[model samples]
Target: MQILSRPYGALHYRLDGPEGTPVVLMANSLGTDLRLWDAVLPLLPRGLRYLRYDKQGHGLSDLGQADRIADHAADAEALIEAVATGPVVMVGLSIGGLIAQHLAAGRPDLVRALVLSNTAARLGTPDSWQARIDAVEQRGMASIADAVMERWFAAPFRATPALALWRNMLARTPAAGYVAACRALAEADHRQATAALRLPAMVIAGDADGASPADLVRATADLIPGATFHLIPGAGHLPCVETPAAHAALMTPFLERHAR
Candidate 1:
């Protein structure tokens, strides 16, 4: 229930674990909120601050008029300055990953390391994203829920009852919020700036991810100088949700290495 007041509106955020410890800032994908990293939190190493928030237009947060990645990154920069004493380890998924890249490039001082999962510098092309925007604009969020589920989860996970919960989360998202995010994604291209980042970074991909395929994820990894790349087998776009244990396993050691 924590909320941070900003020019756009109130942003919903949750801060857990001890104060003064290293912070892990997690950003969710387009249609999700802070809960996107819920399953992975308890599995992570102890004695660290975990900060997650619902981006503008998602979760319980305000959906301002912002339609660019930089605007979203600016909100995050405000969060870091308000709560953190120093830089943080940013772990982002899907569009969250794009947000991380933008932050690390624009506010490198606020980010100590990065874990980019199931995302790319440039996601879908403008035309492809426009088509998606048109679909949702015309039929609403539910219209694309099934297609999104396929890209989000592998067949095995889709068969589980848990799948329905996430599907509903997608369908229930605010259309305006979702559309704003789609507009942002349609115009974002971070490759040029991300390739210039020099800090520690890790890139992860789900072998079964249809949205950001392995090859695309690998190409993003190739852009950064010395980034460690990993592939999670049998997982899809949202691996932190589908395979939290595996996701945390990769993140634990990295957190320990960079802990303040």
Candidate 2:
């Protein structure tokens, strides 16, 4: 129930682990909350602090007027400055990846490394995002939940009872918040900024992810100066949710070098 106030509203966040440890910040995807990375946290090594928060308009945070990734990035920057002991290993998923790009490029001092997961410099096209916005706004979050689920997970995972959890999570999102994030994705294109980055970085993609496919994600990785890319077979967009162990395995060593 920790909270941080900003001009927009209050941000809900949770920071775990003891004081003075290297911080690892986890940012959520669209239509999700801070809990998105819950399964991935414990799998990582100990001796590090974990910072996760619900973005404005998602989870328990206030829905601010700002709808741009830059605004979200600024919010993350503010949170890190107020809470983290120093630079952190930022793990950004989907739209969260865009925010991390902006934050790292603008406030390089706040980030020690990056793990851009199931995301890209730019996501769907403006027209595509506009259509998605129209659907959710007109028909509500439920209207797009099924389609989103398809892109989010593969067929096998969808059949499992666990899929109900994420499906329910999507159906419950605030339409206003979801729409705002869509607008941000429509306007975002971080290729230039991501390319200019020189920090230790990794880009991960689920082989079956329809939203940000492996090739698309690999392309984004290529833009980075030295970012390593990994393809998780049979997984979808949020591999951290679908296969946290695999996600953690790829990240642990990287974190050890940069974060610890």
lDDT of 1: 0.92
How many clashes (backbone atoms < 3 Å, residues ≥3 apart in a chain or on different chains) does model 1 have?
1
lDDT tens digits, residues 16-114, model 1? 999889888999998998888889899999999999999999989988986898888988899999988899999888888999999999998999999
Model 2 residue runs over 4 Å out of place are none
The most accurate candidate by lDDT is 1
Q: In candidate 1, where is summed lDDT lowest over 10 consecutive residues?
A: 63-72
Q: Looking at model 2, report the run of 10 residues with the lowest lDDT sum.
A: 62-71
lDDT per residue as tens, model 2, 189-229: 99998889999999999999989999989999999988999
TM-score for all predictions?
Answer: 0.99, 0.98
Q: Give the per-residue Cα lDDT of candidate 2 at 77.
A: 93
